[model samples]
Target: MKKLAVIAATGLSAGPAFAATGPFFSLRNTDFIVLVSFLAFVGVLLYFKVPSRIGALLDSRAAGIRRDLDEAKRLREEAQEIYASYERRQREVAGQADQIVANAKREAEAQAAKAKADLKSSIERRLKAAEDQIASAEADAVRAVRDRAVQAAIAAASSLLAQQVGAGQRSAGIDEAIDDVARRLN
Candidate 1:
């Protein structure tokens, strides 16, 4: 409106019909008519649809820009959400790994304790078995020595009986042998 008023004022002031005509202006009315006609043509074109076509094109461009902005915002939000979810999953995995490690450590400790106990029991059993074997061996050795001693005593007694008893002195030598056996037994 202000630009239109300026154009109107300039047109009215430059007209010879409103004031004195200048020497450089011969067809002032013609210039004024041409100016009004041009302004009318421009106004008619704008009023009809030429400006509206250009405005609709600009409005569609603006809408496209807004859509692009909204899409970018939504995509950015989705990326952020994905990053957050990934970080959460990573933390959970780390926690689970730590739990597994702790459980493994505990299990290993339990297994170690069980193995130590088994080893100790096994050693005790082996020691007991060794002791039993040693006792048996000692008893066998004592028995064998006693058997050898008994055999040696019998051999000596037989040799003495054979020596002391001549061909005719058997009864007296037998009596002596009995006395010697009694003393040896005591």
Candidate 2:
């Protein structure tokens, strides 16, 4: 192994021995052709493959942009739908509130009407009671007046009859008449 390593090292130390057999001018002339060939090879590669690679990259970017635009449009439509649904709900709630207010107003009006009717009925009952009291008082006054008038007439007749009859007989008749009235009252 050491001998092989020494032999390899000796071979590598020897100067570069490979050289072209042609004259230097011929080789210098070939450099121009080689440079042109390399440039043509690069140009052909650009013409044939670079545009396709670039087109693929551009298409990928365009597809991504299109997808983003479509997503944005879809999201906008969804937002608009949600807003419209919310507005519809608001309208329904407002309508229900209006209906509730109307019902409350109707209920209040009905209650007011009932209260007014009750008040009227109570007033009528009070008025009837007052009228009855007045009528009873008037009847009692009429009876008292009639009884007083009858007593006055009886006294006047008794006085007149007393003047016509003898004193002793008139006194006995007056006493008997008073006794008869008392017995009838019992």
User: Per-prediction TM-score, please?
Assistant: 0.61, 0.49
lDDT of 2: 0.84
Error of 2 at 7 (Å): 74
Residue range 114-146, candidate 1, lDDT tens digits: 999999999999999999999999999999997
Which segments of model 1 are wrong by more than 4 Å?
1-54, 166-186
Top candidate, metric TM-score: 1
Off by over 4 Å in 2: 1-82, 179-186
